[model samples]
Target: MKTDSLVFWWRSLALLLAMGLLALVLQPFFGGTIALATMLVGVLGLLAYHLRNLHRLGRWLNDPGPETVPESYGAWEAAYGQLYRLVRSQGKSQRMLSAALDRFVAAGEAMPEGVVVLDSQDRIEWCNPKSMQHLGLDRKKDLGQHIAYLVRLPAFQQYLTAQDYSQPAILRNLAGGDSVLSVQLVPFDSTRKLLLTRDITQLERVQTVHRDFVANVSHELRTPLTVVGGFLETLLDLPDMDPASRESQLKLMFEQTGRMQRLVEDLLALSRLENGIEIREDRVDVRSLAQVLATEAGGLSKGRHTLRIELQEGAGGVRGNYDELHSAFGNLVSNAVRYTPDGGEIRLKWRVEDGCGAFSVEDSGLGIEAQHIPRLTERFYRVDRGRSRSTGGTGLGLAIVKHIAQRHQARLDISSEPGKGSCFCIRFPTNRLLEPEELVTSGQ
Candidate 1:
């Protein structure tokens, strides 16, 4: 068969031939029976040698390691050497394959999305940690379990049965709590599949918010547009209408247009604030700014309410965009003026508390409920829609204030009790506060 085998057999045959020749010589010297006995002994010795080598080979095969290769003489040596080389090569190849498999597993573990490998029968073969979290699967307990049984959503089951994986399936409120998952089945090979899942909860929230915002904007604009359009149509129809009636209609139209204009301006301001525009780091004079806001509040109140301004001595300035801070402060003061009843007191204060500069607008108004305070900064959120519209509020003021506070690395703290009054404060961090001495030095 093999060259090594052939060499071994040839050597055995030569030895036998040599023994036969010796037997012939012995037959002449001794008797025929003695020569035959000598030949039989030679054959038995050869058999014993071969049996010993075979036993060694068998032992080595049972546990073949680098250091466990059996030593041999003649043709057996060559055979053992070949086997040793083959075992070492196979060991090297197996180590490389194991390393590659480990790297692939590590990569899957590091991914943010979930990954589940399924067998031909849709049974769980393996899954990464993220997949376990997304799908609520346990590696030890859930291995070999069918995917459909674990994810019991009817839509997912339908998608699986349909076998048309062209588009991904969406599951909302998965695990019963506002979690959205996008599940997709991919057939990677003939007998297995890849079940990929991505958590799109935040994405879904953003889309919902976007839809609500568009609808709200449309609703807000539609009323004023309808009013203006109606009045225009009436005026066009009544070409020879009385001057007094014409004047009244025009005034109403003008007010509606003004309201629309304010809404658009507030919408634009909110967009600019949310779009991450670069802010100017101006050292704003809070004392002078408070005085200006007081004056403006007095004008807005128009003797209907009492106004008070309190400034902390040596409170100095805050470092931020002056325009944004002014707008935020103005919004708080204006809202106070609008909501506070006649004879109600409105106080504007600039002070330092806990090593941080703080500006607060305290108002004696119809205070907000505790639940409404958390979402007060959401765009177009109103506590009383009718009163908010009547008071000329765009409903985006607090949202603007929030973005401004965030830009300046500040916190907006709101505290209010029903019928007691509301206090809205923007607290600047210690780093953003310029003390009196620092301001004076900078001025010098």
Candidate 2:
């Protein structure tokens, strides 16, 4: 009842008392029956007015609003005003709640991680867009459906049954492919649960790579260290050994140390590149660089292979760090020299292809298989580990070249066949390339 309701009943009682007094005052002028009859009519009229007001109030309540609040007299007027205020206040609160809900839903939809709301029965209540993608859920079709039935992963089912959500469960290939998800259930409000999922595919890959890198580095260093240690022990034991045998053992030790040193240097170079070391942007003369590479390749080849240098007339230059580019180009040329058979031809070319400046090393040597080309840029990836070691390759040459290319906003392109030949090219975008006139304008 409204606070004004008491006023309404009090006012009604006061009017009834006044009517009774009027009936008593007219008792002598009329007669007892007439006066009583008059009082009864007054009472009936009051009852009819009250019933009519009640009917109006009931009708207004069916579609209650400030404009639709029924108007009345006396205390009823105050009652209608209070009821209208109450309805307006409730409407305002409902609107505020609705806006808050909208904002919360928008935030959830924009989140990167997946979020799903579940009822006490583990049935879907709502899910964000990411949850739909991560869990392969259909919002329209999957709502009110059991989450376990849709997910259908044994680990997930077991996790739900366990109900011990102290730790998250890792689900692999949940949505198929190589995808990984970290899923956890958080109980809220006694019955409802919040199902959170995060894509961990890249994280898992990075961890695997980290583990492999550590293992590979350990294995690579252990071999040479063991050989060096064994030789030292042998030499210490046999100090009176023949000079020829001693000299040979010393040379072997020197080679192993040199290999280890090279590996360390390559590792450091790769690290620097990966760590985004600032590059010194300078105009690098490609023609002169090619000649230098050719000379170095010839020395590395040691008359075992025929080396040739080709320079396109308008190939011009590129804007990049001179030493980094030199290192990149040197790696390609050296790789060709190392891998090619005796008397095989290694051609170093600097040319402008499709408006992009390109430096290519083509070798008629032991070529790589097609499948190995994709992973060639991975550190220490070798098609044949023994052959790579025998050829004095650090298995980081291509990886280094790739990083250098990326830093310079260029790309490394490799094409090879098993028997015929291989071509490795670093193509700099047109924007990075300088025409002959531009090079001259820059006083390079």
Candidate 3:
């Protein structure tokens, strides 16, 4: 009972005592039997009232529906009001807990990584949408199914049964596809665990690129350094060397140093492009730019390859950084010159197709195989390392071209056969191309 109920009960007891004392005092004026009757009547009335309130309280405890608490006087009223307040408080707490649970679920669903809840039996209980994407699982269909049976990967089955989730397991080429998932288990409760999966294909690719970059850079620098060091040792130890021999040695050393310098410059250029250089909104004339690049290619080729420039007025202009676009176009033209044979033909063209500007460099050289075409843009990747060195390439030309094209929202389409020829084209979207009037106003 409540404080108010206790106080009301005490007050009623005091009133009953005063009535009994009055009845006892009235025994002298009236008879003893009359006084006893009066006391008995008053005591019975008090008992009846208390019994009625007790019944109301018992009924409320039994049913406890949405109806208001029944009316009563004194202690019963206090009891009813307190019960209602307690019920409302508990309802508010329950609602708050439910809201918190909902927010937690929402947050889990919004996560990029896949989340799965599994029972102790390695059965799927719940999974987020990302899990569906990463694991190729249907939430409704896969639920209650054993995870090992559904996954069907031997390594994954082993991982699940191991029960030692200290580290994540790498699942490569899962779902008979090219996806890489890093999976780890969190034993959150005694009977269940949380399975987490992250699609790490892109991360793995980046790591591979980083490793290859390091190895390639070391190899490239080692070659030139070795050559230069050998030549310097020859000059230093052989003081009586002939002047002609010394001159030849020095010339070779200079060439090696130049090669190393070119390699470093290309590496730095590629790094800048990858790290995001500022793209200017200047108007770039495809025809004029191609002409300049072709001229530069002629110098680089030194008449080793026959070069031709074809300007077909592709949307007149493109909007981008002039120097960057020039560098990209220059790299493509120079690559063609270096890769093509002495008497081979290289055609440079700029034209519009489907309202998009396309710049192409076609070379009648040792064309790439179809399998090697996909990774041609990877930095330092070479189909023929020896041929690349002989052709005086830094092995980053196409990579640089790819980055610049991407920066300008362009796509590089490469078509090549083993012996026929290879055509490399950078196609700019229509928005990146400027019409005649726009080009004129843009001062191209």
Candidate 4:
């Protein structure tokens, strides 16, 4: 090893002093052997220490280094320190990223709509809580399974193959009863896809109702107008006809005109109900209203049918527009009289049940089937079109009843069996039911 100037000068001084002492004493080997041995031992020990340090540095460079070292260790320690800090920073950043990802996943799981992630092979990689619930998925069994196999819906399978990201596809959930879903496929990364599902059962139902409403309205109007037009043409051709025949023709024309007017009025009422227009709410007495309806129905029936009243004593009154409630109840009673055969019994009942006021009309007429019961209140829906026409029904009676009941916060219950009889009941909510004192004071 090369020595510094100070070490070289000190060594030189030591050697000179040793030689001078030997010469002054005239001794042949004065201190020469001792001095040589001491110098040799000192130099060897220094070399060994330097070699060990060099070996340790080599090992550190080959493997991993310590976290800290003294500054005196020079470039080796500085380089190692920089590397350690860089690794530590990266580890902290990775932990933060992992935490953020966990939060995102948790949020998605809590959503109401379904979410699914898929790989390039169309295999399920991950799914959220809603997805499992909507699809009835068993996570342990479904993981890594082909999406088509698990879902098996034709629309969803087609969507996956089509790779069309512009629009979503609608699929019915066969596993769930009568549930519908709108599914969308989105490309995430180069090899991954995101499948989103939203429930649209209610929306679909509304759309269907809209479509049926338009068609039924058109048909109902067209039929009446056609009959009126044909009758007018016949009258024009028979201007000089016999007086008796002319009278009968005029009577028929008047009946058709009345039917048309009623149909138009019912149509207007339905429109108003659908648009949520505000109407005046007044207290209506069911007993008095039923009595009035019985009188009107009696006139319509010409006393051919028996009209019976079954009023419960002190039955609370309903809160609604008087005219609307009158029309609704009147339609039910009149329809019973018109539809029932001659001498048939039409019973009108008013009572309070379970803290709610209820009005029921029971008639011995042709009963409705179970399948038709749900849609009976739909506008212009006729179970027997020919019978409805023959009876001069506007085909909007039950629809009007349904609307009025809904507006008054009442529930309509219909019970009928084939060839037996039908009962239509309207139950008013407690809030819409009046106290007995109020009913008595109102002269109802």
TM-score of each: 0.90, 0.93, 0.80, 0.74
Q: List residue ranges in candidate 3 displaced over 4 A.
A: 11-49, 65-68, 113-200, 236-248, 302-304, 313-315, 435-444
Q: Estimate, for each residue in 1-444, the C-alpha lDDT of model 2 and write its tens digit.
A: 545778877888988998899899889999888889989999998899888888999999788887888888875777777888888899999999999999999999999999999999999999999999999999999999999999998999999999799999999977666899999999999999999999999999999999989988898899999999999999999999999999999999999999999999999999999999788788888887788888888888889998888889878899988889999999999989888899899999999888888899999998999999999989789999998999888888999999999999999999999988899999999889987665532332
Q: Is candidate 1 or candidate 4 better by TM-score?
A: 1
Higher-TM-score candidate among 1 and 3? 1
- Please give the lDDT score at residue 285 for candidate 1: 86
Decoy 4 TM-score against native: 0.74
Scored by lDDT, model 3 comes in at 0.86
Order of the predicted models by TM-score, top scorer first: 2, 1, 3, 4
Candidate with top TM-score is 2
Error of 4 at 184 (Å): 2.5
Those runs of model 4 whose alpha carbons end farther than 4 Å from true positions after fitting are 1-96, 133-136, 172-178, 235-247, 440-444
Query: Whole-model Cα lDDT per candidate?
Result: 0.91, 0.91, 0.86, 0.79
Which residue pairs clash in candidate 1?
none
Q: Which residue window of length 10 is worst by lDDT in model 4?
A: 68-77
